[model samples]
Target chain A: MLSDLYIPGASALHRMRPAWKLALLFLYCTALFVVSHSLMLGLGLLLIALGYGIAGLRPRHAFDAVRPALYVLVIIFAAQLWLEDLAMAAFVTLRLIALLMAAALVTYTTKASEFTDGILALLSRAPKWLPKDKIALAISLVWRFIPMIRDQFEEVREAQRARGIERSLLALVAPLVVRVLKSADEIAEAIEARSLD
Target chain B: MTTRDIVLIALFAALTAVMAVFPPVTLPLLPVPITAQSLGIMLAGGILGAKRGALSIILLLVLVAIGLPLLSGGRGGLSVFFGPTAGFLAGWVAAAFTIGWMTEKFWDGLSFVSATLICVAGGIVVMYALGIPGISLMADVPLSKAFMGSVTFIPGDIVKALIAAAVMVTVKKSYPIIGQAA
Candidate 1:
């Protein structure tokens, strides 16, 4: 859903290690929490965008990535307008967009396997008494499951539409729930077969 | 737990624990501040699905319920459950369920990015619904006010959702087998 905004390409940004990218991503996000403003944040956002461009992404691709979350951007904009002033709200909204875009740029270029491995490497740094393998497995599993959910959602939607149940949350939510439960079993079996146990 | 397993679990706990302690934010307009905790929820739900995700939260909540101050403000205890953010806190389970189910059902085509969107949609929407109402009732504020306060989170939440969804999609695109969601 969110990742589609990625400009499909290879570049220096894309070639960076996932661990390094994630660290940069984290630090960049943290910077947003601190002071987000005209030059600093704008420049930050711009650099990130430039990185995306250098990675061969077009304007349309960036738009596509943030398009899904547009509603959220609007809502937050509204909240800012309501709670504070138009200026503050606008500033915050722009800052957020920039930060998320930067983050997405990193995601857009990085490979999933490396991303998962990067997270696992991060997890392995924990003190004694933590389930590093499970955490890594969980991260990998979630990443793997994304496409499955999208595919199932379309199938269920089509199935429901065919059944003439238009816009029923049940039609959507129920199958989703069932499919998830079933997947769990399949995953466990796979894991067992692989002897991850 | 075996020595290695113990080491691994600690690692997982540490990630979440560190996140809990970081306490980053976008704004202070609302009393119930927005933190990266939702990202934690997304990660937990996206990665662990139901049982494991639920377990991760429970482990964190246990520390909170026992007065470990494991929440955003370093404030925790059973009392925290009754506070304004409780609904959002409690929403973690349902959110996980929603993400897990969505990812499980459609694990083949949607991509980890899209699955992340599902996870975040359920996680945040349900979280706020619960959090707002819980906060209203607990703080003696009008429900509408509580709802308004939550407005500040919409943009960030949406961004989080998109990121989660996008990441999921990308992953699924690469390793097709990772789709077993729930």
Candidate 2:
């Protein structure tokens, strides 16, 4: 569930280089803060909607991008209303929505590998002790292990549940950590055997 | 770092992400849901020691920056770096480092009480030192108001600290790894 975020598309946004898309996203977010007017933010939302459409994504995609942030946005909205005025509340909320949508659009279109490569390229100019290759390996390993660990957690939870254990943090985590560490040992040995380092 | 160290770091980073999969405990008054992911921060530092523990969190944040949706509620991307939570995100790295440092310092006679204190120092104290100001700046609220609002998270975070201390002690006895690793 980690890196399968790229939705298949043949649109211009999809075809654009990952680095450029990321840069533009950065610029858009910076500009969102610089321009405080709600009208401009509304226009920015329209542009993001147009972006989703141009990328052949549906309205649902835009909604999905903003949905995770709805709670925080609501809280901010309420806080702003209490602290300031109704207009300020709407402005702050709209600004965050615009930022989330623009950023989500890039992730929806860019492949994980392409994104990683783009990041690595950006880091290529860093000092030598950084160990770029090792960092890359670590990233790939993280991607590989996220789902595996999720599965392990579920399995452990199920086993514990069968034993009439429920909602015990130590009971759940103790076994999960042990199993995960055990697998980490095996993975390390495998990497050593292959001399992947 | 050794292969084992690298793998341990990656595995812990994965653990942190998996922690986010659990449903957050929400309070009606507060906007942020209390999530399990921060417990992973304490565990990493307590288990992996200072260097590798901090590296693992930095690695996770890097992935988040590139838009993996690894955070709770599937929120990620460059935008998160600019969000109200950005300071807490930065604090995670520092917190892990602090916890690891304290754990290693007390490894010779590490107790549950000491471990819990370490988690509280790093996870709650250090985290809020950065996070409160972040909320203050991003939400355009005063520092005092931000600090007042953040009081709700402390009890939950203390619970996390206690749980992390227990897990750390168990792991240390069952499969010691902090100083054992190359």
CAPRI docking class of candidate 1? incorrect
User: Runs in model 2 with CA error above 4 Å?
Assistant: A1-3, A120-127, B23-34
lDDT per residue (tens digit) for residues A90-134 in model 1 = 776676566546655665675544544565676778876876766
Writing each residue's lDDT as its tens digit, candidate 2 over A7-61 gives: 8999999999988897898888878778877777878888998999999998898
What is the C-alpha local distance difference test score of each model? Answer: 0.56, 0.84
The residue pairs in collision within model 2 are none
lDDT of 1 by residue, B11-90 (tens): 22333444443334454454334555565566555654554555556555543443343455444433344323557777
Query: What i-RMS does each candidate reach, in Å?
Result: 14.8, 1.9
TM-score of chain A of 2: 0.90
Please give the distance, in angstroms, between residue A96's alpha carbon in candidate 2 and its true position after superposition: 1.5
TM-score of chain A, every prediction, order shown: 0.69, 0.90
